[model samples]
Target: MDEENQQAGPSAAAAGPAGRPAKSELVDNQNFEGQFKFGRLVVILSALAFTLFVSFLDQTSVSTALPAIATDLNAFETISWIGTSFLIANTSFQLINGRLSDIFGRRTCLIICMVLLAVGDLMCGFAKFVVPVTVLAGIAVFLVIPQSPTSQGRMRDKVKMIDYPGMFLSLAGVIFLLIPISGGGTTYDWSSPLVISFLVIGAILIIAFIVVQARFARHPTMPFRLFERNSAKILFAHNFISGVVYYTDLYYLPLYYQVILDKSPLTSGVLILPLILGFSLASAAGGFAIARLGRCLPVIRTGYVLWTAGAGGRIAFGPGTSIATIAGCLVVEGVGLGLSMQPVMIALLSNTRKEDRAVVTGLRNFLRTVGGAVGLGIAAAIINNVLLQHLPAGLPRAAASQLSVLLDTLPVEQRGEVVAVYMRGLHCVFDGRAAGDGA
Candidate 1:
């Protein structure tokens, strides 16, 4: 193994209590942090925060916009793809981007990502069609976000070190798995040969990917050794579940407001502010609390309690539900998410060897994003299947397929039934989310 790979390899056999890495095995990179002056560090953090904000906005800004996009393009059935496609691309390339940053320089990669995002955003603004814009944005952001600086390596060595087979397997696996889930009920029947074929192939490839990581890759993108500690396993599980809940809420809540509540897109966006503000404030507070308490479990547990309550509250949503009640539930859910998100990272870093920090961090992100993609797929399937089964018989199949457009054009007398059916689908989604949180 190369020198970098040796350092990044599995921890020594000797273990601390609970199979955790020994303190002596943990390399402290305090000097790296010390390299930055206080003011410089502040500037760097601010810039990074802004980058994250932009990236998140790019991910979520489409939520409130989906209703409008569906109506405008008359493609309500495919609207979910705008978000799912981006996440698919994002999740597939996430770990590879981290490795790339190590090979090239951070600054070089960051600049390229920013430029791609800017270009994608600009093109999206002008595009008349939906698919093209989504494709462009997905490709642009695939390698655009997340990473840290590291020493530049020789081109030949870096190229050889890239886990090409692992990358291909992971990328193809995600694509195959998601395509069927997203399209099964909406675009094709669940038992269709194409969907079945893709699912079987995807599963096989995923198993192969795991085998390659465990037995073949010299510098595995996700080192199995990190899961040695029980804490690490729990933390990763929390991260994945939270991602599912977070993205599901972000994507579906606006649909609830606009479609069921008869709110405009702008009004729905405005209403979602409570969730955003509550999450942001709680995240900040949680970070400080962790620093002060020097513990993460308490906060994580508290957050889960709140999250369950909030998610449970969502199942009560109805045509008669008040705006205040909706907003309150959202705030509680957001705060729960905020409280748990950061501390999980801190907990993971505390347990990990410093050499493996970067890889683990990337893996954390990869799993969360993968969860988001899968969650969205499952959500879409549930909603679409429900709509297919429950949509009013009087409505044409063509019209039923594009409910957003139908709502816009349907007479006042016919709209209520359609809206009620849509509400049922949303209720199912919320119920599943609640069950997930409680579990």
Candidate 2:
């Protein structure tokens, strides 16, 4: 009997007294590492990494291209929508995408997303106007993301599990909210009935979304239980603030270079290299440090401190700021961003249960993208309002609205004055950024 029991081995031994598998044994059974050979594991990881790279590239590439796009299309006032629309879609579909991947296989969802992205890019190249092109691109990003298979139930059952009320409410709320934010004081007056109506409707829809998620949904897209923990709340807030700062800088910095510093679009892109390189290097370094130290809080704290200082430093940027000063400030901000990014995600994952990890991850990304969309809208409103007030009064409405492309057209003497006004607007933006970072 003893020899026969020994022959049964560890798998049988992993059962509890009730003859149920141990929790750890169940987890081990689900481990992808145990199923794949070393070479196969490498290929899987590489493919996933490449997918992530493509998504990130699409997001960041717009920053440098914005100025040129505005100039080419003569749509300076509406250009923010290009980025905002992408983020809005990202924020809206983020959670649903996870649920969708559960219903359809991961491979199927990925193929669809990639097809949309490719088609969207192709249309953008041939696009003659701004708004339509923006819409196309926005629609395209259904979000090129990957999800793991969760083959739990029948297709019909899986489809029924989706939070339809949560999906429509959130999507509608985001669109209504963003329309006013992006257009108020530019396309429409702040006090316009159109703006006020959208704002009120959006708030109501968002509140309704929360209520549905909390009280009604069978499988809530955003589980309220996650926010019950204080740590999760803090991490969510941190990610939101970081996204605001990151996208604000990404979008505005290139405009500053091209408009105030008189640099070409290509040159502006090149100048931002310090920030990008520093971020990449610091992210890698932070990962290694966390692995070595076996903790994340220290790195996170240091990152916030550096980021705050860097944001404050950005306040000094103007027409006369040196390239060296700009580079140094950007480096500091980039390092801070890189250090802060992964650690927070790691902390959130550490705090969450394994089963809830997917939802928590989706929520994190959703909040960040929401922050970015809101930040861009706020920045656009500030700059456009200031420009409306300070731009040369005699300029035509068309020219004034298209000032992003009017630098060359303005008289030599007026160029300096226009640049000065732009700097003032940027100052307000940076001030708000510094305060947000400090908070």
**TM-scores, in order shown?**
0.88, 0.87
RMSD list, candidates in order = 5.6, 5.5
After superposing all C-alphas onto the true structure, candidate 2 shows an RMSD in angstroms of 5.5
Error of 2 at 215 (Å): 2.2
Per-residue lDDT over 204-318 for candidate 2, one digit per residue giving the tens place of the 0 to 100 score: 9999999999999867777788888899899999888887888898888888888888887788888888888778788888999999999999998888888888889999999
Query: After best superposition, candidate 1 residue 195: deviation in angstroms?
Result: 1.0
**Cα lDDT, model 2, residue 389:** 83
lDDT tens readout by residue for model 1, 304-323: 88888989999999999999
Stretches of model 2 off by over 4 angstroms after superposition: 1-30, 74-77, 139-142, 146-149, 395-401
